[model samples]
Target: MSRTAPAPAGEAAPPRPRRRIPGLGALRESGRLFALAGTTVREAFRRPFQTRELIEQFWFVAAVTILPAALVSIPFGAVIALQVGSLAQQLGAQSFTGGASVLAVIQQASPLIVALLIAGAGGSAICADLGSRTIREELEAMEVMGVSPVQRLVVPRVLACMLVAVLLNGLVSVVGTLGGYFFNVMLQHGTPGAYLSSFSALAQLPDLYISEIKAVVFGFIAGVVAAYRGLNPRGGPKGVGDVVNQSVVITFLLLFVVNVVLTAIYLQLVPQKGA
Candidate 1:
């Protein structure tokens, strides 16, 4: 047996490196996500494209998302109409209700509602699917077979999400506008002619364009975030659930920030015109 003697008195061992703050860790993760998104984009346009997978993802996402989108848009439009109509009546600006409600729905509500549905319904589904595959070692087996999982698994999903988002945005805009019209005319006893007349009074071409742009951007963000969380899960069924939860939370936060930034830019570059 060998005996070691300690000769240090009043001397301390070296301190371990401190862990990064949670916020800093989140920033680092976000940087990694951005990098992953760039890589996905690069691989998306590569040869031997996965057209079948893209189509499958498109239908799957649409099937799951459409009902929720429709449900939410109707109530959303009704609420906006009710509130705006009441306010217009109070301010004696009833003639402007159509323009205000339509503008509000298209400019803000529709995109936000569609984004929420994408994140809550479609994003969670993606995360769960990929997370299960990850836990099952399917992704690892793909790597062993020299297949790029990002190209095979993520790119199609991302593209499909973007396509569906554009379509859903248009659907939501139409449905929400109709819902608002129904409420304004039937429930509030507003003149349908006035509502129809002022519908586009405060809107410009840019409004529709911006709404579509927002849908595409939000869809891309949600897809990338979900794929990142799913592909990087720790392990086990619980890990899948955790990743799904995190993906939704992260997507929501990102959407809110992106929406604010995009709205600010739109306001600066394309100010709303008078009725």
Candidate 2:
């Protein structure tokens, strides 16, 4: 026994060197995201409206983001209107901006902005809350208590995030449309209501479908990226801060990539320009 003890030594295996592959990492991330999305849907249905957490989450995103996004978006619309307006008139196609601008803005920009807003509020929230729990070992305690943190803590928030995303997208579109409407009134001497009616008319069923679908995908990416960063953060407040930055940056980048692909898909799937 003493000889056996002398012959045995145990040490923690060296940490595997971290490796990252761009496309592979994204594909793996996509798989993880898909699982998280399933969990999110399950938790959302399980709790139903018991917690009011979903409502609170929606309010947090919409309220916190409304002002700045409002400020940014109206002008974005006006700018689009102004530029596109001139081009449309020059090309004798001034009546067509509704479909073009509304489709582009709602399907494309709205999702991106919503992702950024959630990244600032909900994404930061997921990181800070989870990171603090991690630092204090609350998550560990849950583990000891036989609760899987992912199931207990993450699933609900992930579901709430997707719900919040829907609301956020709606908020941005409304605010942006309104702002753009006002811009047309002020800049081009067009009535806001009339301009908006034009926009509404052009915002066809397919456009709404595209916009909503984009939101779901973008929201999923934002949720998973934020969750991954929060779950894998380095120790301490400094580390949490680092993770926050990483979460936002990665989510934004992924959101953009997704937006591009979704745009391409939309073009292929939606009715052609002339049709």
Candidate 3:
């Protein structure tokens, strides 16, 4: 058997070798985030619920995200309409421009817009608030007093994010669709009747379903990611800012990847309106 050498007086011992696995840290963080999401969901259903906290968080998230959602949606819809109109005209399928543009906005743009706004505004607020509590040891104090911070705080915020994202998805869809219609009819000289008729003929209920589902999933992801970073900020109080920025970036990346996956799966499973 090999024996380890002892350190001399007033000298520190040699550091032990650590097993470094590639991507282990990232895998561990992903696991923790998923665990946190599960805990939040479980705690969300347990009473006594944080009704007031949920309401306040919902209102606050909506307050911060509402105007931005509207503002962003208008430009997004206009661009989509213009691009689709140009393409359809080139293909001699100009009558289908409204259908194509509205479908793109509803199926793709709206949920993404809601996710970006929520992740930017609401997620940052959540991370900052929780990170401050964490650094101040308020979460620790609550644990000592027998309160589960996930139940009292995280759950409400997560629920609030979900509720607000769903509502905002609807808001963006309406505003964006109207904006697209206006741009197509007025700027592109598209007949209003043709635009409305084409949309009605091509738009299916499944498109709306997928959009709302994406919003809910994106909301849950944003809330969980922000809470995870907030609860595990490194380097003390100063690190909270870094964590907040990281959470937003991470959420944005996750949203796009998830959107692609969801869209692919929906296309595979749900048949098109006329197909």
Better of 2 and 3 by lDDT: 3
Q: List the residue pairs that clash in candidate 1.
A: none
C-alpha-based local distance difference test score of model 1: 0.91
Better of 1 and 2 by lDDT: 1
What is candidate 2's lDDT per residue for 65-84, written digit by digit as tens? 66776666667666766776
Q: How much is the lDDT of residue 187 in candidate 2? A: 68
| Top candidate (TM-score) | 3
Residues 1-275, model 1: lDDT tens digits: 99656548888756669987769977889799999999999999887899999999999999999999998999899999999999999999999899889988998999888888988888899999999999999999999999999999999998888988999999999999999999999998999888977875777899999999999999999899999999988769998899999999999999999999999999999867872
Model 3: worst 10 consecutive residues (lDDT sum) = 229-238
Provide the lowest-lDDT 10-residue window in model 2: 1-10
Q: RMSD to native for every prediction?
A: 3.9, 6.2, 3.2
Clashes of each: 0, 0, 0
User: Candidate 2's C-alpha lDDT?
Assistant: 0.70
| Candidate 3 residue-wise lDDT at 137 | 94
Cα lDDT, all candidates: 0.91, 0.70, 0.94
CA-RMSD of model 1: 3.9
